[model samples]
Target: MNSSDSLKLVVKQQNLEDISHYIYAIVYPIVFLLGIVGNLLSSLLFSVTKLNRTSCGVYFLLLAVFDTIALIGGLHHCLNIGYRVAIPNATYCRARVFLVYVSMDMTSWMIVAISVDRYLKVKYPITARIYATQKLAMIVSSIIMIIFIVKNVHLATVFIGDFSSNAADNCDANPLYPKYVAFFHNVWPWIDLTTYALFPFLIVTICNAFIIHDQYKRRVKLRKRNLDRSLITLLLVSSISLILCNLPITILAGVYTHISTSTNTND
Candidate 1:
């Protein structure tokens, strides 16, 4: 392209980025406020009230805590994009990225745990009574935390801060670890797809489907309202909303990954 055309293209891209930054500046505070308020109320209801007595409630409490953490992690992005506050160094980048991943993984898997709990409680009341105890919920939540922490620990070492400018895209994988660089580019996207979206989506969808079918049959046979109607409705809404919100981003990431992979192969 000619110099004028290239200059115009650059200016257009810069304009788009500026627009996005302004959008983030506006939207993020609203999300942070709403998320914090909602999660705090949820935490209070689950922890201080009788809701905390159940396994489902235990999962929710943990979800609230982790979701809050995830939201806080997002502040870095807001600061970077909106305020031009660059990540200071490698340590900050690593810690920020690590916390974000761990918290997000916890939130995603916690939903799966809740869905499974609901499934068991619905399909096998007797068996669920035995297995779906608060203690079991604690244990399962702990295991999920431990697993995600271990899985994402490499983030602490892998990412390095780029100090060239006050741009939002600051962290990059350490070039010293070629294997990790390859994994980060070529493999990590799929892993994220499975962990963050696909696996949870499949599990929650299947479990909820079974729960819904069973509930329908029971309602037809007994002609009574579902005992756990409120709780079930809450789970259904959360699961559906989670999937819907994540779907667009998930598909976009998958497409980007595929295109990137093809480009690398052609190179």
Candidate 2:
């Protein structure tokens, strides 16, 4: 394209991104409110429901708790990135990013734990009894949370709020590693995309597939009746949702890696 055309293209792209940012600002606040309220109600319901007294219910309840935290982080992200509401507070900037990632990581891993617990319970009913207890679910969720918090602790230091700088007023983590910032931005997101998103997606899919197959066998080969298809359906739906929700961010990470780092002009 010619220079004029190129300039128009860049401006158009920027306009679209701005439009998307504004849209996100509007939508995410609603998302944040609904998420908090819905998760709270669900958490209470799970805690009271007799079905949640089981190992599976415990996992679901913990997932709800993690999701609630993530939703709070989501509000921070929407306000800060979309509207610059939290950009002035350095502590909030740092803490919000850390909490966002850590909570999201735990959320994904908890689903993994849930899927595995269900798979084992169906695959090895007797052996799974001791392994898939509420206590075990709690321990696993806690460990996963701890591991992610430790892994992402560097976020707090990296994300600084320095209004003195001429960089945009948005809450972006400055490039601490100046020369390597582009490379870092390009690669680090993928590491998260892999460990937190892709890995959990693959694990959940495999576990749920096995669970479904086992359920089918029990129904067809063994002449079993009264199968609880609801649980299986829930697992399938969750697996699909994880992939669908995360794939876009993972793709955007790559897109940002390419565009933001090409000239070291953005973060």
Candidate 3:
């Protein structure tokens, strides 16, 4: 590469980094505040209403908690990337990264639980009422949390505080653990894509489809619909929103991982 070409490339990279920092700086705080307020309102609503008495309510209440934790984890990362605040220690770095992944995984599976709950309610109302108790929801949620914690514990050991001069380099894979680092970069993203996006998307889609079909059948029969239409509507909307929001990122991540793997192989 010529000197002029190298200079231009350097400037371009710098500009891109600046843009990323600027975006994060502007976006993260706003998102954090809004997310906090939203979750709080949701919790309050669940508490005040009879919703808390049901399995779906249990899922939602826990969802708010998980979302709040995920948001906090994101803000920690944003501070490092957008405001030049460094992670203070290795332990903090590991904990922060671990919590972020675990919380996110929890959130994803919690949604799946909610979808399943809704499916049972819609498809087999009598059976659901008999089996899908609030106690069961709590047990299921706890199981999901524990599973994700175990699944993501490796994140705690694999990540270390990046002591680099650049603040944007907050936490990175520990070089001493080559196998783990390779897994983190080369394998983990795909696993995350499946767990975080693809799997949830699939479950939600199938559940929503059944719910929709059941609703249609009810309408056709002109039977007084026993299921709560509003809740069903809400489920449909949330499922669609999740699919739309997650699909692009999931596809992009998959493609990017493939390209990166190919590049690393070539090198």
Which pairs in model 2 have colliding backbones? none
C-alpha positional error of residue 216 in candidate 3 after TM-score superposition, expressed in Å = 1.9
lDDT of 3 by residue, 1-267 (tens): 999999998777567556646756888789889999999999998777999989989989888988899899877546654665655466777787688778878877888999899889879999999999988999999898888888888767645534343322445566777777677768887888888888898899888888888887887689755666786778778888776766665564444333323322322
Alpha-carbon RMSD to native, per candidate: 5.6, 4.1, 5.5
Judging by TM-score, tell me the better candidate of 1 and 2.
1
Taking the tens digit of each residue's C-alpha lDDT, what string does model 2 give over 193-244? 9978899999999998888777877787767765677977787798999999
Report the backbone clash tally of model 2. 0
Better model by TM-score: candidate 2 vs candidate 3: 3
- lDDT, residue 44, model 2: 87
Model 1 lDDT tens row, 1-267 = 999999998777567556746755898889998999999999999999998989999999999999999899888767765665655577777888789888888888888999899899879999999988889899999898899988888778744433233212456556667777678767886787778878888889889878877877888789875556775787678678778866655564444333323322322
Estimate TM-scores for all models: 0.82, 0.81, 0.82
Query: What is the Å distance of residue 1 in model 3 from its true position?
Result: 5.2
For model 1, which pairs clash? none
Identify the runs in model 3 with alpha carbons over 4 angstroms from their true place. 1-12, 158-168, 223-236, 244-267
Pairs of residues at least 3 apart in sequence or in different chains that clash in candidate 3:
none
lDDT against true structure, model 2 = 0.72
